[model samples]
Structures are given as C-alpha cells and as structure tokens.
Target: MAPLTSASDENTHQTLLNTLDIYSAPKPFRNASWKPPQRRNKNTKAILADAARKESSQVTTANSGTSTPAADTAPPNIAQAAQRLDRLVLEKSLIAPGPAVTYTNIEAAPSLRPERTRHYCDVTGLVAPYTDPKTRLRYHNVEVFNLIRTMGSAATEGYLEARGAHTVLK
Candidate 1:
C-alpha cells in the first residue's frame, strides 16, 4: 500500500499579506479598560447621583427601623445585596485583631489546603497554566482561550456549572 501525502490545494491559495481581526481589535485594544460607549455624563452625573442617593436613603430608612437580630443575620434587600453592604448591620463586618493563619490537618482551620491540584482546563480537561480573568476560566492553551472567548454567556455558564462554580441566587 502506498502512503497518501501532499493533500493541500496550491492553486486556490490566498495570499496572507494581512490578517483581519474578527473582533476588529488586537488583544490589548480588545482587553482595554476603557469601553467605546463611555459617556462623560457631564449633564447627568448630578441628576443620577441624586436619584441614587434618594433611592438608597428610602431603602435604608424603610429597613433600618425594623432591624431585629434574626433579620440582621439574613441577607438584606436587592440593592444592599448587590453592593454587599448594609449600614444597619455593621457588627459582623469588622476585622478581628489578628493576622490570618493557615493550619494543615486541622479540621477547624479557616484556611485548609486542597487534597490535590485542581488547576484543570475548563474546555480541554488538561493541565491549565493560564486563566482568563474576565471569565475566571482556566484554559490549557491559546486555542482553548479562543474557543472560550467565542462561547456565549449561557455556554460559559454551563461549563462553570459543570465545575460546581456557578452562582445560585435565592
């Protein structure tokens, strides 16, 4: 049996003089902090800020008077939860006067080491040396990174859910 070799079509070859960015920007430009739709909002800043202050004040006043110990322990309203803050419940937020410590083989240790290495690629299931900061997804290589970037939010959530990293809202 003869080996089949050289399967590329040469006549139809297109010149690769220039590479077009599918997303219309290089990595740095695409990953920059400044978004294109950034509005100066010079005219609306005061109005928006005033509205936000009013809303928050209303929420705080409505919830502050009804504060009980049980209610304090539970999560607060939507705005408070989103900001991870409640001015009324300020007891638990203070830091304890001690340096954080990690103890191995101690069941009650706040910081315990994992049983094994868990840095695996979300897409390829291989050893991942890089993480996509935006998605918080570990990928094995650039190919996996490109694949992850092309994925829709639902698909990304599916991958995160498979790893038990998806957030559940009550």
Candidate 2:
C-alpha cells in the first residue's frame, strides 16, 4: 500500500470544499433595484411645533371673527381616540386568572456563557481560528475580516484522504 501524500491530497480535498456553500461569502446585489418606504423628512418635534402654531393662529382668527363658529378650535383628543382603538383591537377574556407567581433561585440558575468547541479546519488550510456554525458563534466585524484574510491561505487536502481520515482510527 502507498503512503498518503499531502500535495495530491490537498487538490482533491479543495474540490469538496469548493462544493460546500459554507465556504462561499454572500455576494452583493447587482442592481439599484428598489427604494425604501416613504417617510416624512421633518423631525417629529418640528412638525408638532408647526402644527401647534397653525392651530393657535386658527384659534386667534376665530376669536377675532364677527361670526361665532359652532365648534371650538380645540384639536381632537388623541388619547380618547387611542382608547377607542384599544377596545376595537383588543379582546378580553370573560374570566380573568389569579396572579401568577414564578419561583427562581439564583444558586440553581445556569450560567449565561456557552460551551466552547476546539474543532479546527485543516482541510481548507484554515490552521487559525474560524467560526463553527454549531457553537461559539463570533459576531465582530474585525474578527470576520481577519477570518476572511486567513481563509485564503488555509491548508486544503485531497478529498479521498479527508474522507478516509474520518473513517480511519486516530
């Protein structure tokens, strides 16, 4: 039987790596397709101030006018309208349950930290640290950038040896 060679091994191994979507980075969209939803450019405070001034002027004009308007210049009560909306949107249960109590002991609580896995990807020549989708997820932009930089130089082996290694005893 012939001994396993690293050079020929890497060529076949890389082919399997190329087949997996895990190694591929997401591509940018090609077209300037669609615009986001329309929104008022003016700040909420500014818009409110302008509306208040307009309402005040309307009240002043009405007071100075010869004719007495039937309705007052007061803005519609938004809170009352919101209350009406609450009744319309939300339904209450016929019978209400008693206050619920939950028991939580700090001593018995599990730690928020996650368990770490030490699996490394030597197949792609990624000798340095890389993300494992299963555990220890990394989110930092700098770490992700570093991973991409290091990934290009990662060591890859032939597909047959890689597959055989999994079946063979350590």
Backbone clash numbers for all candidates listed: 0, 11
The residue ranges of model 2 lying beyond 4 angstroms of the native Cα positions read 1-8, 23-32, 41-50, 57-170
Q: lDDT of each model, Cα atoms only?
A: 0.64, 0.45
Model 1 lDDT tens row, 44-138: 45665675577657655666544433654665568756444464345223322222222222434343666866699988999998989888788
Instruction: Report residue 67 deviation for candidate 2 (angstroms).
Output: 20
lDDT of 1: 0.64
Error at 131, model 2, angstroms: 62
Candidate 2 lDDT by residue in tens digits, 78-150: 8866765564334222111222122332343456786874444433433336543432222234555455445
Residue 10 of model 1 has an lDDT of 40
Name every residue pair that clashes in candidate 1: none
Best model per lDDT: 1
- Residue 169, candidate 2: Cα error in Å is 96
Q: Model 1 misses residue 22 by how many Å?
A: 76
